[model samples]
Target: MHLPSRPDLTKSVFGPQSDFIAVVFSPVLAEWDEGAFCMPLLDLLVARGYQVHVYDSLSLAQESSTLHATSENWDAYLRANYPQIDLAVGQAYGGALVNSLLSGFLKTCPRVLGLSAPTRCSAELQSNLASILTCLDMQGETAALDLLEYYVKPERNDKYQPLPPTKVEESGIGQRLRIGFSQLMKADARSHVNNYAGHMLQIYGAASRLVNTDSIVVSSDNRRQISSGISGCGMRPVIEAPEIALRLISDFLD
Candidate 1:
């Protein structure tokens, strides 16, 4: 097996001695990418002179010969290395990981904030997921492969084709892991958002509500979601993140 290699994470970003530190976690699909919705916030923190670190949960999960990179592993890493990290930000599946980490890490900080994070797992989607997982033959090791054929990969006569491009680049967190992980997350707390449904729900919810707050950048695409159906719902005013990111970081460090 090709053992995963750790990215030179510390070398890529600036970590200042400021009072607060913001650690951004990536989606469960694994491997943290630079294009994450919250990257701009990290840039903003860097500009303000607070220390910033973007934890590559994907990288850690794959590269750490010792760790599996699930939500729990990510949480443990935070407790060990950043027992003091204050503010955290994540998107989609990333939001779930960050939220879980906060439940534990917040003991070190005063308060925690979630951007488009799901508070509970969805209980109504079980039958639908069960049907889907059954069609994918989720009982064996090839379960992930089964799901890809049914969901992630374009259905065709041949099963060997290039996979679809994900919102985030990098592939250590394979389609099997992504989809299988998502399916298992249907009702499980640790798995749901960090799994799939919650991630999409949070992002969808955030897309609809990004106009009211000043914590994040409201992209034109997000603006469109505000007017059109996002993931499924209509748009509304929500928190913008730039200022929130800065303030959260300041508080975390102090």
Candidate 2:
């Protein structure tokens, strides 16, 4: 895979050559690097002829006082850098960021896609995540990984194979995770969804422990409320069913 350079707010430019321009946001604890977990999705989009721009929410969060502020900053960044967006795709915490900014995007982007996205956060979920982070800080990566496995409840499938163990000791990873969780806790995407007048396809893991599948689904009122569209699908986690997830994304993009 050909990896793009890290996003520079002042120096980076979205190329003018591709037919489609996609801005993808990475989940918490993940960066837009060669080893990024979302590389497969990026590679697939590139192969499909998109000029893809990737951003890491953790980095974005570091620069802002609040997640909403971060979303606004990103909105400005997109408007300043890209002529227009063909599609927007985000996963996990990235999905939440996309949701938070969906209203502003509706004017320039026609379609949006969210994978394992959550629309609302409950106190229980917040508490659980806090516990996970505490484990990361006190007991280290091993404990955190164990707790993460418990939360994700990953399953093996033909299309979704287990990934090799990753080292979680990277600098600032823990801080990013904390910031991501805090942002998620404060995120409320209902207003954005209600205001967006464009096509949206929200996909979630039927078995996902992190996000409540019901909260993210587009309600009938939302379907009628949106100007362009609202739709959704549920499947196994991407890591447990990559082919299914990829196919869903391809179909939506096509």
Candidate 3:
């Protein structure tokens, strides 16, 4: 087996230095630095005295690793860096990624919040995702953004906007995008969620076409896991319905 190398997670630490730590992962479409996508929730947490560590890394970072290996790297990174983690939050791909990591790592499960998170990648979803992969492969980010637009159009929530297409000529990211999708195609977080012993809140948009919320199962054995649906939103529910999303997270944090 080709053991993938650890990612140089040159992350950004925001908010005041505090005992409480909130580790955040970014959605697939947005880079980790563009925290606005997961804003309000992130901002609210900081205001409530949590030191937020924003991971500003590549989408998948490791091109050859299996989903498990990728998550293992994240787990190891956290273990080496933090004495303890109080909370975990991620959106979409990030959500799923963190879910997989939390499912297995950490002796004691921390409180986790996932938005538009999927524990499994169904055959139908795999098929739909292939087209986006092809678009990224052939036309690059501009054309890929067009397809993402289709993803969020139905929600009629305009608040969440993916970064405008980039004109920079970096070839490495293109390769990573292809590799990332390949891994994402086969990524399954169900096993992770099933094993996770932490208190979790999995939230998805009712109108999300990207993921079938019914498929995101938090194993019945984990009584602490809560799965919720937000109306009038799509994959990007945090930005689309900031008020409701913040309230839900605030309540959970409290």
Residues forming the 10-long window of minimal summed lDDT in candidate 1: 228-237
Which 10 consecutive positions of candidate 2 have the poorest summed lDDT?
A: 226-235
Question: Please, what is the TM-score per model?
Answer: 0.48, 0.76, 0.84
Predicted structure with the largest TM-score when compared to the true one: 3
Which scores better on TM-score, 1 or 2? 2
Question: What's the true lDDT of residue 103 in model 2?
Answer: 66
lDDT, each prediction: 0.40, 0.64, 0.71
Candidate achieving higher TM-score, 1 or 3 = 3
Q: Give Cα distance to truth, residue 237, candidate 3, Å.
A: 0.7
> Per-residue alpha-carbon lDDT of model 1 for 1-254, expressed as tens digits?
22233345322345567777766654343233554445555666677665766655454433222212355556555666664764555543454455445434433443333444333334322332344345334333244344433432222354444334223332444443544235234313333222221111123232322211222222232222111112322111122334434454445434
How far does residue 183 in candidate 3 sit from its true spot (Å)? Answer: 1.6
Q: How far is 130's C-alpha from truth in model 1 (Å)?
A: 8.4
How displaced is residue 22 in candidate 3, in Å? 0.7
Q: Candidate 3 — number of clashing residue pairs?
A: 0
Candidate 2 on 39-157: residue-level lDDT in tens?
A: 66777777788877766665546632677877876777766666788888777788888888876744447878877776666565567678777777776665665675566553234
Query: Using lDDT as the measure, what is the rank order of every candidate, best first?
Result: 3, 2, 1
Q: After superposition, how far is residue 132 of candidate 2 from its true place, in Å?
A: 1.3
